[model samples]
Target: MGLLLKTLFYSSGFIIVWAMVGYPLSLKLIDRLYKGEQLKKDYSIQPTVTVMVVAHNEEKVILEKMNNILELDYPQEKIEFLVSSDNSTDRTNEIVTKFIKEHNERRIRLFEVILRKGKTNAQNEAQKTVTTEYLVMTDANAMMDKNSIKELMAAFTSNNIAYVTGRLSIVNQYVNEVSISESRYWDNDLAAREIEGRIQTITAGNGAIYACRTSDYYDFNPIQCHDSAMPLFYALQGKRAICNHDAIAYEKAGEVIKDEFNRKVRMSRIILKHILPDINILNIFKYRWFSYFYFGHRTCRYLLWLSHLIVFVTNVFLIKESWLYAVTFTAQVLFYLLGIIRGVTKANNKQLTMIYYYCMTIAAQWVGVYNTLTERTKPFWEKAESTR
Candidate 1:
């Protein structure tokens, strides 16, 4: 019993550390050996493209988003804005229609999916109308950098490139403690994706700034995130899904930690549901070097909640074994204590709020795991309240 407990303690501890630290370090080592393919980026070429914005109830930002797209640096005639409405009952559809009529912008179009089957379903239904070869998908609140489209298209310099995702920056990162921590989290995420992109394919892409050829776009399960699934989806076919950091998009971070937590829960659950059923990822012979990264970046990090739980549970059992164990256990307890204190007192201390946000993140992942286990995952999209 003691041996098993010790094993659990050490093993879970390593996973918690590895998911947060070791994976990025290993990627840095891999970077030296992996010199990815050279790009033949040509800024002069303007391929006709469709910007697909999937919205549920986005009246708050729909018109502004349309304006942002209109002001983008892409050749005006070469770009088409396709707004895919997922059974939106709000003024989202009306506002979009009104904007198009007021400007007489033939380039802007709206399509609706009344089934409420979710964002993926909405995109799938709307995709039938896309006449362009390459499609860029963005959230309604995501504002593209002036040269974002050109940079994304530049990365697709060859047929071997499956997709190109851009870096995301939080426009309201300094709004609050939650936003500050979220900004830091995104910085780490962008760094990780940048490293993985250097390996020829990224593990995943986000909806805020992701682009792929219309022909290569998979009809994802209604419950799955294309952002989470498409990078691997294209990789399985020997195509590179690269990240272009020069192509940037800005989104407002949720002001409240709990709102952020719920968003993470939905994301984690959706990612797990999408990845677990695909046995192709485990076929090392097929994925080759990418299988190593998939395990390190996606699977290990997704299962972090389990590791956190095991480490916490086993720490209580092993506290009597050594002074070192006691010290470590006490440190863990105090970390949670700080988070709780800040939550209860609404304290303005920077350090404690950050700790609280981190704890809420882990807790959300645990809830995601619970939802996945209980078959409670749904095929509906919920926009963060603070975002729209």
Candidate 2:
């Protein structure tokens, strides 16, 4: 019994460490040791592209989003602006129609899906109507740089490079300490994905700005988000889905911790509940590279809360056995105590709020896992009011 407890304690500690620090460093080391697949870059490849702005009751920002896309630097003859509305029962459709009527030379069109299916479903619907060579899928809230689509197109120099994701920046990072914490977390995430792409296929794509070939786009249900699921899908097909850091987009960060926490809960549930099985992640013999990276990128992080729980629990019983165990127990207690204080008092310390944000995010993953396993998860599109 003692040995079992010790094993669980040590193993869980390793998992926590790996998820926090070891994984990104290992990726860098592996990349340095063995340079992975290189993408052939030709900056002049501007193919016919369709920009699909997926919207769902985004009346507040739909007009701005349309105007944003219409003003891009891409060729007017080559770029088609598509406003894919997922049964938006607001002024969204009206605004889009007005924009189309007003900007006929910009080649803007609105496709309204009658069903209020989730984001992926809306993408599938949009793809069916795409007669272009490349399709760039982005959120209505994501404001792209003038050269975003041009940069995304430049990466598709090789047919094997079917998918390309862009860099996303939070526009309102200083809204509050919580926003600052989220911005920092996002920077780390973007760096990790960039390194992963440099080594091999990226583990996931960014929802803010990503482009894929019309022919290679996978048609998945609403339950599976294209942002995370498409990378695995392309990997299974022996294709490359990489990150182009030059393609930039900006989005508003959540104003409060609860808003961001709830958004993570919804996304984690959708991806964890169906992504593994839907893409056949366990078929290691066939998709070995994908299996390895997905584990490092998602599986480890999603299940990290379990390891943390085990470590804390095991340390409780082992504290009397050794001074090391007692010290670890105390440290863990203090760490969590600070997080609770941050929660209760809503502290303004940037560093302390970041720590609190980390803890709350870890807890959110467990809640998502619980929601998925117990069939209580809702895999649908429900935008956070705070973000809008």
- Candidate lDDT scores, in order, read 0.85, 0.84
1-388 per-residue lDDT for model 1 (tens digits): 9999999989888877887899888887777767654445778757899999999998889888988888888887788989999989999999999999987855889998878988888888998899998899998899988899999998887898898999888889988888998998888888878877776678888889889888887788888878877888788888988898899999888998767988988887765554344768788888776787787788777767778788889989999999988998999999999999999998888899888988888889888878878999887747788976
Q: In model 1, what are the clashing residue pairs, if there are any?
A: none
List the candidates' TM-scores in order: 0.94, 0.94
Worst-scoring 10-residue span by lDDT in model 2:
270-279
Identify the leading candidate in terms of lDDT.
Answer: 1
Residue-level lDDT tens digits of model 2 in 22-92 = 88788778777877665556778989999999898999988888888877888889989888899988899
Model 2, residue pairs in steric clash: none
CA error at residue 291 for candidate 1, angstroms: 1.7
